[model samples]
Target: MKIVNAKEAGEQEIERLLTKAAFDQVELNPKIREANRKLFGRDMSAAELVRQIVRDVRNEGDKAVIHYTELIDRVRFTPEDFLVTEEEFQAAKDEADPDVVASLQKAAENVRRYHQEQKPKSWMTYRDAGSILGQAIIPLDRVGIYVPGGTAAYPSSVIMNAMPAVVAGVREIIMMVPPKNGKINPYVLVAARAAGIKKIYKIGGAQAIAAMAFGTETIPRVDKITGPGNIFVTLAKKEVYGHVDIDMLAGPSEILILADKTADPVYTAADMLSQAEHDPLASSIVITDDAGLAERVAKELEKQLADLPRREIAQASLDRNGLIVIAEDMRQALHFANVSAPEHMELLTEQPFQLLPYVRHAGAVFLGAYSPEPLGDYFAGPNHVLPTGGTARYYSVLNVETFMKRTSIISYTQPALSDVSSDIIRLAETEGLQAHANAIRLRRK
Candidate 1:
């Protein structure tokens, strides 16, 4: 990991250090290009390849999804094989470990309760006599959630993404996951079932997103798509934004810790490695004023890395993206964290709550050493699908409102129209909207 003194680092150097790993066409890795060459007999960026796949699925529907599944995933499936049958669900239930299933059910209940509190109710108020202005909260008719598969199965993702929609009173929640050897992960299936997800599809990647956004013969079109996936999936979500709503353009996981001498070096190092193990692109950074604590955390990271099952990936991530900065004081460390706008931020200072008000940008803030990032990821009753790539400055964690739509309600009696007609006409005329002015003029007449 790189270590630097923030007091001595130039502003531009700090900015470059905080910049996210770019996912644009120009940043396409050699492996992605190699895959494109093997698949298409030509070099193509991930964005271009996603565009082609999205276009094919939009135009060809089920046939295109099947074709891409065979070509990209080396799995052949007909329309009938697209949907996971009740038999498969039952099999997954039977095959799943009873203890893990029970634990998932408990986690699902926690998630369900948390999101239930976030559900918004429709409300109205009559401020003027004979006039009604309000908002109607309506759950989406159907939503599609994409759970990542292949390298690993994320059953927790199913719980995190599905529970919010379920709590929002969505009529249907459709889940899609990549299949391995023509089979979806039993744990994922068990999690979906526990979360009240009725419909499951054995599909993944950009094609799955395209299928949901545009709809195939077997897959119904969804009003929105949520959950995280690879670059192709992210690009596909970007392409289909107007056609369907998406949660956010998620990137690799990240965590930043602001610590002081009082912070436990062991706990801080474990928290950093938690995010570092997520992906090779994942970033784990620490900013502290205590030089001795910084050195201890560094040594602790080395000791912890040896025991992690994903040590190679974590080590690569720490080597390439991790950083330890010696700040002048706590104020400077907090400033650095705000500028980064990390997906997860931990306050390991002596008085974490005292610094809480100063945290301006972070998807989620874990206060003190006890509140580890993984606690929120698994069972803390908070959504783990957070904004990445500094998007926490604007984007938010997935919640009930993400699956619900709000519509403005307007009602005006003849008397109310008469009261506002003149003002409406004046505004419309000022804007040179003759039709809008005429409509109000006729109403008055």
Candidate 2:
């Protein structure tokens, strides 16, 4: 990662480096583009491909879902092959290492416990003239979670997405994972079991999103869909959003570290690489007032990446999106960090907690040298499905509330209605809502 002096950089330059066009429409890489050309017989944007796949699934149901599974993922499935059977779950349990299963169970329990506190409480209050105002918290009846599957397995994704729904009291939840080698990853299955997910479909990609949104012959419709995936999956979620609720349009993973002279370069470089290793688009950045620390961290990053298994991806990410900004001071560092609005932020300074009150925007904040991003990603019990691509300014991390809806409760006695009748009628009439005035007027009578 190259180090740039923040004072020398123009505002436009900083923005272009940090917040520029991260949300620009997803583009397919050359390999995927070639695959798309061969499969669809034409070149199309990621949005175009997603729209066609979603429309096909909307119209042809399971048949279209199976067709895309073969074309996109290179995995074949019949309608009956969609839903994972009990035997598969059992096999996953049997095949999984006993210690790993136990660890996942513990992590899931921590997630469940954390989300239980986030469950919104319903309360009613008596008001003047026998009026009562309240809210009813209703859990979604059913929800679908899309767990990405390819060459990797992330049981943590399952735990992060599912536990909140389970804690919110969702009645039924199903999972969709892209099949790899004609079978779902056993560790993911182990996580599903730990998180209390029942129905799982081996189907995946944009078609899996569409099946959940519109409902198929085999897969049932759901109220919301959560979990992160590749660009195509994100685009599909964007297309089907109005038809179904989505957690957030999360982009590639990223981390921004605000460090001071006291911060350790080795720890800082390791943390930065943690996010960079996620994807080639993933961004790893450091903002520090110390130019010496900046140089040391950059050197440490080069040294550490030499032996990392995913060095190619991490190196590509660093070359493309990573940087170190030499800020003037801690205050300036915080200012630049808030402007970036990163998904995962680390405060590695003399007083991490003292800086907390100034943090304006971030999906999750990691405090101190010991609290790395992965702590929250796996065992820390916070939802890792966070807003990225500078969307942290308005979006939120997924939580129990993501699966729960609140409905207002209104109850008014005759006296209460009379007290406000004229006011309501006057406002309704002022707005040209004659029917609304009539309803209140008739009720008054």
lDDT of 2 by residue, 1-445 (tens): 6679978985557656778555462373566567678889998777788999999999999999989999878888899988889999999988999999988988898898888888889999999999999999999999999999864788899999999998999999999999997899999999998888889999888999999999999989999999999888898999999999999887888999999999999999999999998888888999999999999999999999999999999998899889999987888888889999999999999999999999999999999999999999989888899999999999999999999999999999999999999999999999999999999999887
What pairs collide in candidate 1?
Answer: none
Of candidate 1, the 10-residue stretch with the lowest lDDT total is 19-28
Instruction: Name the lDDT of candidate 2.
Output: 0.91
Residue runs of model 2 more than 4 Å from their true location after superposition: 23-25, 28-32
Shift of residue 36 alpha carbon in model 1, Å: 1.6
TM-score of each: 0.97, 0.98
Instruction: State the C-alpha lDDT per candidate.
Output: 0.91, 0.91
Cα lDDT for residue 209, model 1? 98
For candidate 2, which ten residues in a row score worst on lDDT? 20-29
